[model samples]
Target: MFYFFFAVAALITGYFVYGKIVESSFGVDTCRATPACRLADGVDYVKMNPKTIYMVQLLNIAGLGPIFGPILGALYGPAALVWIVLGSIFAGAVHDYFSGMMSVRYDGKSIPDAVGHNLGKFAKQFMNVFSVILLLLVGVVFILGPAKLLAVKIGFNLDKNMAVVVWTGIIFAYYFLATILPVDKIIGRLYPLFTACLLIMAFGLSTMLIVDGYTFFPNGVGLANVHPKGLPIWPLMFITIACGAISGFHATQSPMMARCIPDEKCGRPIFYGAMIGEGIIALVWATLGMTFYQTPEALQATLASGGPAAVVDQVATTLMGPIGGFLAIIGVIILPISSGDTAFRAARLIIADFSKVEQKSIAKRLLIAIPLFVIGFIITKTDFNIIWRYFGFANQTLATIVLWASAMYLVRHGKAHWIASVPATFMTAVCATYLCVAPEFPLHMSADYGYPIGIAVAAACFVWFMLAARNTPVEVDAVDSPGVIG
Candidate 1:
């Protein structure tokens, strides 16, 4: 109980202290015209209330990451809690703040464009493909979970597979409209309510757990490897907990809100604060996963038998009763739907930016979005485990690249680059290590070889960054202005 509350307090405190320092480093200029003000095309660039944007951005970057990922991460015991607190504050939030603010600074360019601006054209081109694929994966991943859940909850009485198909079609239709429509039309109007439900479910369950004395850390938190499979804590836990800690996927989502933020000052709360909020949710869920089950072995058994969704249902029903279970289901269903729509939307915008196509025309939007939806639908037929495994790796790899790019942005703009650079180095090692050891990767190496190789790769990259930083000239402008991506 004390540990859980302390972790929550740490995240909140991180937002006020470290979040403020990050905002200061970027030098937020309240007077500067944001993309929404300077480039209001009434389509993607329409400005809305900052509060609404905060909720929308929260749902956008969140999806099933904080909930599902942390539940899976809990197999590693309290070590997951430590990662959630430190990773969210130091890496995830910082990555998000820079990704969003950099887009705002660059006239609302996509993340690939922002990455390319700092990293190089090659990087820009690579990220263009990388981000689109990641978004599509997100769109597809979010769809399957919700579709399956809705099918079961509704009990259509049709063939179970058929019910899933019907729900998938319904979700796809919504994604189409949400992608092609203006930001305020589908996403902005609906997300706040959904976000409220999501928050309430998280906090409500947390409160009930506290009342039940279910979340007390009787073992007083240790670093023991508690996974039933005995998975190493180093990279596996990091990957499993990507969304709650740090995710490259958030970088893709940030640019969408970047185009809507009315002032530079909103970046901290909307981006960094949202991440901190996610961390708290993750902490609650991780704590629940740890304490709700009798033992790590039992949690693993429950997971293997029915998955996280089953665990969530049992917990909600047990603690909060029927109404709470219904609300929990609805909130969990909304999690991916809210994020899935924007994933497709972000993909459409990324493709438009890459192809130099204007988005003011509905036909033009369809030209990109149709193929994307078609591709996403086809991907749903593949193995979910394979897609999720690759998504986890790709997600972290993207975060690693974005952090390096963000570090480069600070290096050229002449702020405190270490804030980003340090995290960049750490994620680089994590991704490198995962690549070497993960079964999904072709290398199929053991942890013994992967660890040293990963550290060496990180060290090499750090040296490269240091050399580049020394040679790169500093700009150090006191004020930011709209700039061309080239």
Candidate 2:
């Protein structure tokens, strides 16, 4: 419990202290006109209230990633808490802030464009495809995830499979509408209310934990691998706990809010602060997972029998009572649904930006969105577990790329590049090691081979960055040039 409180406090402090350093390095220019004001298309680039943008950004990047990820992450024991606090402060929030602010500097273009400016055209084009596929996966996963949970909730003598199908259609319908609608109409308006429910659920669970004196760590905060399967803590825990710590998916979502930010001044709170807020949500869920079962082994048993959704249902109802539990379940459902809608929306924007289709027209928006949803619907039929496993790897890989891109951005501007470069190097190792050793991959090598290779790969990448940094020309007027940086 003390550790949990300290972790939360550290996250809050990190937002003010480390977040400020990031904001300063990025050089948030309040006097400069934001994409929302400068490129007010009324569709995507509409000016929004800072507070609303903050809430929407939180919901956009969060989804069930923070909650579900941390629950699974708790299998690794108290090390999850250490990762959440440190990762959110140094890696995740910084990655998110730069993703959003870089978009603001680039006239609210999608992430591919932002990467293109710094990492060159090939990186931009690569990210364009990589980001779209990841967004589609997120949309489909979120759709199926909430649909199944809601199916259980609305049991009416309906076959569970049929109920899931019914809810899937309903969620996809909502995603379609949210994808095409004006920014302020659906996401901007509805997210704040949904975000409120999410916060209420998290805080309510947190309050009960404190009042009841639940023991978060039965032993001292030891970094032992308590995973029932003996999964090593190095890469698996890091990948499993992506959003709660640092998810690259958040980078894709950040630009969506970047277009809506009314001023540069709100960048830190909305982007960096949202990541910290998610870290808190993740901490609450991780605590519940660790304590509610009384042991990690028991938690693993429950997980095997019912999966993460079932765990969420059982925990909420058990701890919060019937009424509060129902609301808490609704909050859990809302988590993914809110993010699902935006995932599609972000996909549409990415397609439009790359395709050069002006999204101001409703016809053009649908042209981009219909094909995307069709693809998303097709993906829903695949094994959810397979997709999720791949999503975690792909998600972190994207984060690694974004971190490198951000590093390049910083290096070009002559600001401290280490902030982004260090995390990029670390995640590069994590992703590489996972690919080599994870059973899900084709190689499936032993950790003995994977560990050394991962470190070597990361070192090579760092060397490449050092060499490239010296050669790449610095943008003298990065703040003024929309053709390069704003």
Candidate-wise lDDT, in order: 0.89, 0.90
Instruction: Please write out the lDDT profile of model 2 over residues 240-265, one tens digit for every residue.
Output: 99999999899899999999888899
* TM-score computed on alpha carbons, candidate 1: 0.97
Q: Write the per-residue lDDT of candidate 1 for residues 260-339, one digit (tens) a residue.
A: 99899999999999999889888988888888886888888888887887787777778789888778878888988998
Q: At residue 286, give the lDDT of candidate 2.
A: 91
Stretches of model 1 off by over 4 angstroms after superposition: 476-486
Report the Cα lDDT for candidate 2.
Answer: 0.90
lDDT of 1 at 43: 94
Using lDDT as the measure, the top candidate is: 2
Cα shift from native, residue 461, model 1 (Å): 0.6
Worst 10 residues of 2 by lDDT: 477-486
Residue 364's lDDT within candidate 2 is 95
